[model samples]
Target: MSARHAASPGRRDEGRAQPAGGGDGEYTTYYGRPVVKAPPWEVDIPAYMFAGGLAAGSSLLAAGGDLTGRPALRRAGRLTAAGALGFSMVALIHDLGRPERFLNMLRTMKLTSPMSVGTWILSLYGGPAGLAAASEVARWAGLRRGPFRLLAALDRPAGVAAGLTAPPVAAYTAVLLADTATPSWHESYRELPFVFCGSAAAAAGGAAMILAPADQAGPARRLAVGGAVAEVAAEQRMERSMGLTAEPLHHGKAGKLMTAAKYLTAGGAALSLLAGRSRVAAVTAGAALLAGSACTRLGIFEAGIASAEDPKYTVVPQRERLRRGQPVRYEG
Candidate 1:
């Protein structure tokens, strides 16, 4: 068939269905083939994403606690942050299959590679977080003398350094995901960072609120509320901005998770505000926020996978780009 003829549309009476991708009346793939391979990532990947963000945000909370002289909050935040980082590392290495392969990522640093940058951020974040947590343990164990004294003295500074890196550490995963061939992730890059950041904050805050004494947990509660607000707002804006690309987030398995996240987070935030001096209410809110944060990460990860598996998302967008005279670089 001639190129023009192939590109031309046939009558609906002829049983030819219209392309749903909104392309310029052209088929871009081989019989609607997927343009990119869906990620072979397992549940561990989103678990890593969630744990890393929680660690980063908790590190920041630890720093805040140190600066504000909230010993209980600092102790809780530092331990929680360090523990989460350890889990994040394990999850990442688990996803990489071989532990040695995870080490290979440290061989070189590349500004363009989000994975490289994220690896470095995690490493830098780990040192300070570990030190702070260790210092707290030593102090609690009555070993705060000589070398331990120095560690105790430097804990605040180390926490501050971790805090400095925490925001990017929490947010870099979004960039890592966006720098992929997945249509949903790439399309939502603008909002993903904010979404991750807010989720991280909420997770960390929730942890702190649960572990810290109520008197010292005020900041944690506030942070949870603020983070929940940011998360909800960013998600709503992202869906609106994504237009048709947002379908996966609102349908199927991914949709169910997101819907649950919305309700859980909103309820948690509301409860945090209403639970004045009520321990039960505070704990409930914390649990809800933590669950909501996990749901958000899983939902987003699944949505990306769904988008990649669906050929319409890949072919239609590229076909439209071709019609617009834009360069189409296929992902290998």
Candidate 2:
């Protein structure tokens, strides 16, 4: 037998017979070879994630600003929240196969589908945030004196609404990814929420420092530090728990992106301590953290897609289960 033919199961010397097709024929399995295809959805999924993180973080920063009586930070936070929400809406709609049917997503609630839950959350949260942001702008334009008074009255209510939704906004994106067929994302579901929370916090903090006066940036800096620490801890725990499945974190482009994120997060947190005393340091560190968050988001999205593309991730575990006499359940 030729070297290629010798590698086939038909080449065994113990009463093995070649198939009728002969040596030149292509080998075929009972089922077709596995094919990996990207989801038909646009790349806007990651952008939506980024926007959601920004909105959540901005809301949290706004609350922090309110608690500390930092007007500048509060104003910046509110504006950021509005802008993020706007971008989120745009990205989500852009991702829809039938954009007009987007609203129908709210027709039912299925805990099994994170997208449904996220839709509801966004709907509820976006209303108040949008109102609050608009009111802030109106107030700035001195339109609070006329027919716009009702909108001004909505400011506090909107603020309250945003505050309540902030944490979930950060967390639900993780659930969104987890509910998908991606193994890397689903396996890291427990850690993904915390990672997003940190990214949001860092991004919001950076935006606040960039916009607000130095004194008003203090609370944002603290939030950034807290978020960075939480994110690092969560990532470490995820890596430890996933074992060989977590190989994506240490390989190729994903590894480089994650590495950059970690360094930026850590360095930014360290710099935040002295940011209050140095405006330049505060702006520089905040920018770094924001960039880091973007890298982390992109890396996570890529990793999840990679995991879904590899047939081994889907098959090996099932074979192992079969070897142990366990009934395999096909999820997809």
Give me the candidate number with maximum TM-score.
1
Q: Candidate 2's residue-wise lDDT over 239-331, tens digit each?
A: 776554577776777888889999998988888888888988888888888878888888788777776555445444444667899874444
For model 1, what is the C-alpha lDDT against the true structure? Answer: 0.83
Give the Å error, residue 314, model 1: 1.2
Instruction: Indicate which candidate wins on lDDT.
Output: 1
lDDT of 1 by residue, 1-332 (tens): 11222121322212222343543453243344455777789999899999999988888888898899898988888899889989988998988988998778889999989989888888888888888888889888988778988998977788888888889888999999999989899888889999999999998888888888788888898989999999999988988877667889988999999999999999999988854488888889889999999999999999999887765566556657778999765673
lDDT of 2: 0.75
- Each model's TM-score? 0.90, 0.85
Give the alpha-carbon lDDT of every model.
Answer: 0.83, 0.75
Worst 10 residues of 2 by lDDT: 1-10
- Go through the candidates in order and give the C-alpha RMSD of each one to the true structure: 4.4, 6.4
- Report the poorest 10 consecutive residues by lDDT, candidate 1: 1-10
